[model samples]
Every structure is written in structure tokens, then in C-alpha cells.
Target chain A: MRRLYTILSAGAVLGLAGPAVAQNPGDTPAPAAQADPATGSSNRARSSQSPAGGLAAVSGEDAAAAPARADGGTIPPAELKSACERALRDDAEWREALGRQLTGALLASLDQRVDDAEPDQPAKKRKLEPWVEQLSTEIERKIHQRENRAIQRNNNHVIMAYAALWALVLGFVVFMWNRQRALKAEIAQLQLEVEEAAADDE
Target chain B: MKQAMYFVFAGISVLLFFYTIDLIFYGTPLDAGLYFNQKIFYYHVPQAFVLFLAVIVAGVASLLYIKRRDGRYDDVAEAAGEVAVLFGAMMLVSGSIWGKAAWGVWWQWDARLTTSLLLWMLMVGYMLVRKYGGPSADRLAAGLAIFGAVNIPLVYFSVKIWRTLHPEASVVPGLQGSMRTTFWLSVLLFQIVFVLLLIARVGQSRIQRQVREVRERALDAGLLD
Candidate 1:
């Protein structure tokens, strides 16, 4: 439960950290979860209400439904599904963050669907692994593709700027050296002419 | 001393080569939002500082020329003006690239940008007046430089005064952590390079002036070919 709260906090913080902090190009494999500071499983029920992200939003809705069931009433499945979808929409801020959080919600929805169809939680977990793995692989590939393009564009600008600075400095140096050489040659010519005129007079 | 300056300048160039590589690979990561192309900021701002300093040095020398009419002060003013123009061109071009990246436009008529352009043009005008203003060209150009010197404060403060797209002079308040250190270090390197260039330029200008004076003397003594 404490671990769940940490994931929730990371999702919220990732949304708030803005887009720049969200992607670290290629090497950083999702460091967004480090912001979690939750401890103690006693607060398990409250963790769902802790603004963790889309998953917590759905979990909080389930907690709400529990009280409704205790009062001898139940939320219709269709209505509950619509509410969960709306909650996910509001909670997920970044496309990448949404993809990550929705995977959990999707897994839960799949487990619920599998249970309804087969009525076996143990076999259902086995069936879910392949789907989860496939989704994770696809998500990672998309993220790397987008971030690599951004990194490449940024690298181009950096190359252009550095080239320009060195070019300007070297160009100025060459110009000054040529100007100095010309002036020295002119000075030598003037001195030679002055000496010839003096010798002619003598 | 001039020879030592040339060696020191070469050393600084070597340092800049490695420093720029580090900046490319490990400098403060690009601003993720609207300022993604701010890698150029490290280069642009420092160049602007040295450019402004060169302008001020030339302006002061121009004032000295105006006061005593000394040919030495005139030579220094001309040398300083040319150096100022050189760095100023680099700053303006680099700045345009940064602007195009960040602001989505290569040029803007906003307060700070316009005033900066005006200042560059004024420096170029100072050079032109020296080149073609004929007799008493130094005095005329010196007067033009004094006017340009007046515009320096206006150009610097324009963003603050008129609320331009350009950030204010108080960007110091926003800097934090290693970025602040990196910025100041780059500034220090640019100043070292600026001093080296100024020394070399003044020496060359002195030699050119001596050549001109010697040719005038030889012609006066009927030494023409």
C-alpha cells in the first residue's frame, strides 16, 4: 500500500514537473518514481485518495463504491466505467505519464474481464502477463523515437553555434595578420625611398 | 608583451575548444519549455558583455581624443572601435540564431533588439567616418562615438524600460545552482580573450599609423617613385 502511494506521488509530480523533466533522452529509464515518500501500510485505504494519479483515482472510486454497497446499493458497471474514464482523463497530465498509469488501470480492467469470463484469478494472472509485456515494449519504443528526434535537433543547434564562434575568432585573427603584414611592407618601401632620395642628394 | 598576448590568446582558444565540447555533452540541459534552444545563451551573453566593453573602451578613447586632440588617443579609439565592431557582429549574429530558435523569429523590432541593432550600426558608422570622412576624420568619428556611447545605457536598459521579448538585466535573480557557476566561468573566459584581442589590435594600429606618418614624411622630402 505504501509502495502504491509512492507511485501515485510520482505520477502527480511528473505531471507538475512539466514536459522538460519528463524525458531525459535515452539513458534515464523513468526516474519519475523517486519522488515518492510514502510509508506505513495502515494508510492503505487513504492512499487511493492521495492524488497518486489515474490508477489511484480509479481505486478511490472503488473505495467510494464500497460504502455504497454497504448501504445496500450498487453502482451500475456502465456508470462506474464512465466515471473511471473521466477520472483518468482529469488525472493524467502528460501523454507519457498517462500511458504509464493507464497500463495499471488497463491491467485491472483486464483482470476483471478475465475473471468474469473464466472465474479463475490464478489463471487470469498468467493470461495478463503477455498483454502487459507487449504494451510496455510498445510504449518504450514510442518514447525513444520521440525523444531521439528532439535530442538530434538540439545537437544540430549546438554544433552550429560552436562552429560560428570559432570561425569568427579565427577569421578576425587572419584579417589582422594580413593587415599588419601589408603595413610592414609599406613601411619598408617608404624607408627605402627615403634612403634613395638622401643618397641622390648627396 | 604583444607576443605573450598572442600566445595567451592561442591558449584561450584551446581552452574554449574543450570547454565548448563539455558544454555540448554536459552543459545545463536544454530548457524543456519555450527556451529549448538556450544552449547558445552561454556563448551569446558573454560575447555581448565583451562587445559592450570594447565599445566603452573605444568611446572613452574617443573622448580622450576630443579633449587633447592626441593622435595616440585617436589610434587607440580606431583600434578599439574596429574590435568592438568585430565582437558586436559575432554577438548580433549569434543572438539572431538564438532568437530564431527560441522566439520563432530571426529578427524582431522590439525595444532591446532594435536598440542593439542601432548600437551596432553606430559602431559601423564610427568606422566609416574614420575611413571616408577625409581631413579631420578622427575628430568627426570621435564625435560620432560619443553619441554611440550615449546609446549604450539605452540599449542595455531597453528591455527593462519598454517590456520587450528580451529578458531584463536582472536575469541574475533567476539563475540557480551549477548554472550560475557555469555562466560566470564562461564570462571570465570571454574577458580574458577580449583583453588579448584588444592588445593585439592596438599594436597593429600603432604600426599602421607609424607607416602612414613615415610615407607622408618620405613624400614631403621628394621620395616618390
Candidate 2:
């Protein structure tokens, strides 16, 4: 039951904090520890007590980005850029941590199974590394698919925006041009009428 | 000479448009969270600036028309009001697209967006009154223009006054590096475009007024039935 709870907790952590952790390469080791529920509380305390340098990386970036976020809520562009770069670079680190935590739970379950197995049953070789590796690969693939979908959505939004802007501007210009043409024709027609009226008066 | 000057100005505006487009796409760095989507800011914010400028111009000209009772002032007011409607529509449309990209929602009834929508609607009302309000159309639109001009400050300060999805005015002042340069260049470009459009629209308005006067005289003289 404890193992089941641990696996579920790890999944919850990964789902919530995975991308955040991947983007903070300079973060102290507190995150890796926090990723595991067993040591989360104690590790958080240790990190809080650690010297300022341990948190300097994140703090320094935040300081640089402070002006852009003075309004308090919006993420600044520079910080976002740096975060994206770090996420791209340290993506493997996050996947490794996730794999370790997930497989850690699986291994614990396997250990219980071994303990309950008869002494002779344990003599049969059980290689679990390949299965663990395959599971990790599947998770990574799913994450990549989700990221791609998000990126595609962003691209679509941007293209539609630019298209809408240009289309509207062009439409307005055409409207003005057509109005000018119609007015010019009316003016020409009015001038002819005035000329004919003057001839009739003479 | 005036026609030559207008052509020169148009040429320069075209050149600036190309130059700024290159700078926006290539010279400026990608912003963090929105990535390529943030590029919309280069166009969106500048159009907003032009929108405000047009509305203000319309209000001031309308005030002059009311005080002086001059048809030229009315012409200027009408031209500026038309430009305001054009740019206001652009601002709202682009802004909605940006909201969709950044906030995952196309429209939010937040303070800034709501106020901007109101301002745009007022400008549309100005145009509609001008088209169908008979001889008093100019006066009615001028009134709407003054009201819209008053609304400008509300839209400009909406983010500060209330919690909103739109960025604060400080965001422009806070920009740094290439982002700052690109942003100002975009503002300049949009302003030039606004001036050109205003001049063209004003010229058209003047001609329309002349045509009306000429037609009225001919009718008084029994030139046509």
C-alpha cells in the first residue's frame, strides 16, 4: 500500500512540477530531493538552511527579470527565454529523475515480491532493467508528443493573428479606394451638369 | 509640390514598413513565455497607440468644429474618426488573437479589454452617426468622439486601476535592449502610417464637401431636377 501511494505521489509530482524542474538548471539539489516524496520534507528544510549560493542561480535570474514583472504577475520575456533554453538543455536531467523515482517504486515492489518468493524461486534469474528502460522511454515519448502539440497550437495562433491584421488593413484600404473612386465619378458628373447649365443660361 | 511631398512620404512609409518588418523578425530576440507569439506585440501595441492618437485627434478636431462651426474642422473630425475606427478594429482583433495565444482564451471581459472594446464601439458609433444622422450627423459624431477620447485614459490606465490580462503601460518603458529599439521603431512606423491615412481621408472629406456644395448650388439654380 505504501509503495502504491509512493508511485501515485511521484506521478502527481511529475505531472505538476516536471517542466518547472527541467527549466531550472541552476536550481539547488532541493528539487531532485523534493521529487521523491520520502525525503521531500527533510530535503526542503535542508535547502532552506543551505547558504545563499545554493539559491543564487534562480535568485539572480529573477532579479534580472524583476523590472519586466514589476506588475507582479506576467512572466517577463527574458526570463521566459532563459527558462526555455534551460528546459531544452536540462530536459534529460528531468527525465532521468522521473525515471529514477518511478522505477524506484517499481523496484521496491519487486523487492517485496522477492522477499515473499520461496528460496528456490529466487534462484531463477529475473532481469527487470530492460522493462524499466522501456517504461521510461514510453513516458518520454508521451511528453514529447504533448510538447509538440502545444508548440503547434502556438504557431497556429500567431499565424492567424498576423493574417487577421493584414486582411483587415487591406480591407480598409480597399474600402477607402472604392469610396474615392465613386466620389471622383460623382464630382466629374456634377462638373458636367454645371457646364451644361451655364451654356443654357448664355 | 504638395503632391510630390505626399508621394515622398508614402515612399518613405513603405520603406520603413519593410525595414521594421525585417528588424522585428530578425533583429529582435524572441521573448520567453510566448516565444514567436510575442512577435504580435510589435504590431499590436503600435496599432493601439495609433488608435488612441486617432481618437484623440478626432476629439480635438470635433471640439474645434463645435466652437468655430467651420466645415474644415468637421472634415478633419470625420477623417480622424474614420481612422480611429480602422485602427481600433485592428487593435481589438490583434489583441484578441494575442490573448488566445498567451492566456489560452480568445476574449476576457477584463478591465482593459472591456474598456478598449467600449472605445472601439464608440468609434463605430461615430462612423454610423456620420453615415445616417442627416445634417446633424457631424455634431452627433463629434459628441461621440469627445466621449471616446475621454475613454482613452481609461483604456490606457485600465491595467493599473484593475486586475487585467493586459500588460501595464509600464511594460513599454521597462523594455530593454533590441526589444526597446524594435518597439519604438514600430511606433514610429505606425505613426507615419496613421498620418498618411489621415491626410488621404481628410483630402477625400474636403472633396466630398466641395461636391456637396457644388451640387447644392446647381440645384438652387435649377441645373437638374
Winning model by TM-score: 1
C-alpha RMSD of candidate 2: 20.5
TM-score of 2: 0.65
Q: Tell me the tens digit of each residue's lDDT in model 2 across A51-140.
A: 233233334585454445567787767888778557645787664554464445445545556678876653333345424434555568
Task: Tell me the deviation in Å of residue B133 in model 1.
Answer: 1.4
Model 1: per-residue lDDT, tens digit, A21-130?
A: 65545544333322232321122212332234435557677545443555679757788767756765566454345455455555565555566875545673546543
Candidate 1: interface RMSD equals 2.2
Where model 1 places Cα greater than 4 Å from the true spot, the runs are A1-137, B34-36, B155-163, B221-225
lDDT at B115 for candidate 2? 72
DockQ of 2: 0.38
lDDT (10s digit) by residue, model 1, range B141-214 = 99998878977787767644665667655565587766676777778777877777777888887887777777
DockQ of each: 0.31, 0.38
For each candidate, what is the lDDT? 0.72, 0.76
TM-score of each: 0.66, 0.65
Identify the leading candidate in terms of DockQ. Answer: 2
Best by lDDT: 2
Q: Model 2 chain B — which ten-residue stretch has the worst lDDT?
A: B159-168
